[model samples]
Target: MHRLAVGINYPAWAGRNYRIQTASTVVSGLGNAAAPIATAFAVLGAGWGTAEVGYVTAARTVPLVVLMLIGGAVADRWPRHVVMVSANVFNAVSQGVLAALVLMGHPPLWTLLALSAAGGAGQAFYAPAAEGVILRAVSAEHASKALSVFKMGMNGAQIAGAALGGLLAAVADPGWVLAGDAACFAVAALMRSGLTQVGGRRESGPSLVHELRVGWREFVSRRWLWAIVVQFSLMNACVLAVETVYGPVIAEDRMGGAGAWGTAMAALSVGMVASAVLMARWQPRRILLVGNGGVFLFGLPALALALGLPLIPVVVAMFLSGVGVTVFVVGWMVALRQEIPEELLSRISAYDAFGSFALLPAGTALAGPAADLLGRSGALWACALTCLGLAAAVLLVPEVRQLERKVPEARGNLPQPEPATSG
Candidate 1:
């Protein structure tokens, strides 16, 4: 593959497994980006409202949160790539069936919820296993660069997916968009199946309970890690509530509906892609301290929506928020892969995901009711404020404020990217 001229050096040592992992991520991200938007609009198109949309989306997350630990243990016990492939296959089947149902007719709300829950079950297994794949494939020294490239590819896919999903849903039926997502999942599964030499060596025959207990210990051992995870629990809850439920409601009522929402989401993905490219070359000394600053931006779009801002401003806010989220994620992943032992990485990651997502289902479920009680704008305001507050509070921990980069730029075999010079 040809490199970009942006001075972001793709890791030379990111060989077969890493390449396959990145390919699968990029392919899957296309579907992942579009699926929620299509799902929401599909429900609305079915003559259902925010409550039904919330219930269906929340159904997906409930299984993911509930089975996260088990999924982590399974990943650790088996080959990570195998686990990922299996999960993708399951997701493809679930999503394909949902798409078919929608195409056939309106499809009952119960079917939508059930199929969504099934897809969530696949994701519960896929996430932690997939997290370990690229890190395991690349050397520790090159992990950051590899992750940056991986994220950039994923973000790029989302940029296309969001843009197309919105336009397609607006013109054609949302069912067609859902069908495309199912196809993406199928393609991703095929790509992932080729990955070898992914995941770390593990001891055989440990009980799932025993594995989870060990993971919990590693998770809580780091004060900064757990604190940040707690912060994201609230932060993510708010994000999900808005993205899956309230944001669409706002877009439908005021903005131009699916197309407008999709455009904003596409802008967000473009911001993430830009940030990932920047992160590949820029290494900040105080990783978390600088990274967490981006968290403040994460609340902007929600705040804008809550205030009934116009589409243009909301799209701009989404873009800024995307940049912030990408910075935080790249920094967080580097820290985890650097500090945590490879053997325990998947489980610890599982714990991290579990904590971060613990409240997400409730957030989605309550979003509709919250809108009713607090008023739509009032609920959005609450979510936005809670996200900003949690981000600020997490910074109070000294470890989070003082954490430094584990590997210096000069030390890594991958050379620092050269700056472009003007002629």
Candidate 2:
């Protein structure tokens, strides 16, 4: 096995970016880990009904859909480092407020919704800026490998944070987990403050609406890009529906309970970490082909659960599915980074995010009802079938398959990218 050296002399900026990225990954992972437990406690421990929980979760998506593009625009207009730092700081404050509320035994549904909205807004701003900074940090030739490294760090943090959150939720107060999540954000903000902005100042942009239009155009121009987006949207809808509701329901019935679900999730995370490490060493050229092909296996866990497979078989399926997701994510990021211009990269990235995530809430909302009507097993099977179909659909695009033919150059004379206006 050949070890690929990062190659470039470690820039002072790279160190700062690496620290910031790592801290941010940890913080984001903590928040993600806390969310499920927090939401569960809000419903179970604090006496909030499922309807209220549904409302809060649904509300979070509104801001994500409405403000994500704006967040990208802000990242493009301001220094990426500044935007990221500010966003993290805001996130920390929001999480702190939520923790205080929960600890006080006054977890109002409205208050929870508001705090979640604030956090979503912060993410809208932070994600695009962070992605833009990553583009500037590494040379183009190393972009694919760099993305793989980033995924490894991000997924590794998610695994650790989620596992820690589960442990804390089991043994300690849920408020403690929320507080820890807040602390992670504070550290992320501090680390981000040290990063130097790359590529100098951005051009003053046209009206936000105009910039948004440009981003949309860039997004839709590529057949392969939109095809994957369509596939992912459908896939996400199916997966979200099953994973959010039916998977746990099935686990409770067939396995033990939430603990079993957590174990399966942890297994998935381990697989993701392994996949990221593997890709960092061996970047496939036809990323879309490789990614989508791998994604065909993503439905296995749901299928295994739907079929009432033994616990070990289900766990193994979950791990394999996690590997598929990692491959798909890394491949997608590399393709986007290589093809898109730096200026518009953040906005375009936001657009991609928006498109990919658009259906998630719908999926969540429908999952419970769908399970009620179709049965948990039926819903899980549906998700598996959808994933397989989507993967097959992505293979129809020639661009996705041919992307490997174009070896990425170190730096190209491509036109400066336009900033994203809408999220």
Candidate 3:
């Protein structure tokens, strides 16, 4: 009776599977945070330069983008948790090999690129499979809070991981850091391996191509869904460019160098964590409207940079934007779980991710050129205004504006929680 009451009253975090999934996410988050820092240092230490770094980055991203649809189909055909574990295992192997080669000294640039691509391919599969795992683990009543708490855990891990990765890279061989990343993935794989089958595997069908076609049909069927995705495709491209490329250059010219930029990023992370905590407790009526409303804040930091605001004000902008973006992310995940059919969820999510990510490379590549052509302030101003415009325009979609929270009703068909088989 007590256990049942506890299950009824508490959020999804009460379930053993959700707890395990959260643990895996935190551990993987730490690895993800550390891997980039370590990878960059390892490249430089091996006599490679920035061009080689770009090649390695592109190598990883290309496979991830190319393979996402196939990954989604593969996840649907099997138990999603199993796919997640397999993907992590593949990543652990690739990272472990990279670590070994780096430690051996002066590893060829080609090897690094290959291993990185392998890891990215693994991630492509892992990502889509991951979308359904949490939703499957818990009841609808607790899903919103569960996702918020999950994001909080991931953000917190990233903060700790960044600090730890920097320290480890500065004081020790970056090979060791890469090794630690491999270990983190291995551990996460083990944790995820414990999840038992829920609602069974999605029925295997024709070819993966067929599955993708079906997924695309589902994706384009919803006006609200596709509209927001299209908006984000453009918005994320420009916003990320500002954050990664323009902001640093501007900081160097005006505010303090890397440290000032780092502080602002830290502020953003803190805001994300804080807002995740808030969303876990507060249930809003019009989830999409409330979530989309927060997106206006996305352009604030860019606007501040354009206006030559000092570090304090820029940091404040960054923090607020972080909070706003996180609110949308948590809300978006809730919407996906509630509104999407169980079988189609992972595939549609893959489309959503693909849309959001498709333009990112172009944006990053163009940021420096845009600044050179338009002048620094001009570029910043353009990105900020474009982001704001996209956010506003997305809200004009009637479905997005009118959709209300229907978690309970939408999730009535979800599978009931089964007894835990793995901890």
lDDT of 3 by residue, 1-423 (tens): 234322223332447678788889999988886676567667666776444544565566667778888888888887888889999999999999999998899899889989988988998899988987777665667777778888899888776665566566656777888899999999999999888774356455478889899999999999989999899988987886776566655655677544466567667767889999998877787788889977989999989999988999998998899899779987788788778899887799889878877776667657766777898789889989998899889887998888877754233234445453222
TM-score of 1: 0.93
lDDT of 2 by residue, 236-283 (tens): 777755554555556545676555666666677778888988886676
Error of 1 at 161 (Å): 0.8
lDDT of each: 0.87, 0.73, 0.79
Question: Residue 239 CA error for candidate 3 (Å)?
Answer: 3.4
1 against 2, candidate with superior lDDT: 1
- Evaluation by lDDT, superior candidate among 2 and 3: 3
Task: Please identify model 1 stretches exceeding 4 Å from their true place.
Answer: 1-11, 200-204, 410-423
On lDDT, the stronger of 1 and 3 is: 1
TM-score (C-alpha, index-matched) for candidate 3? 0.84
Worst 10 residues of 2 by lDDT: 414-423
Residue-by-residue lDDT tens digits, candidate 1, 160-276: 999888888888988888899999999998998888756545666778899889989988999999999999998998998888898888889889899999999999999999999
- lDDT of candidate 1 at residue 315, scale 0 to 100: 90
Model 2 Cα shift for residue 393 (angstroms) = 1.1
Pairs in steric clash, model 1: none
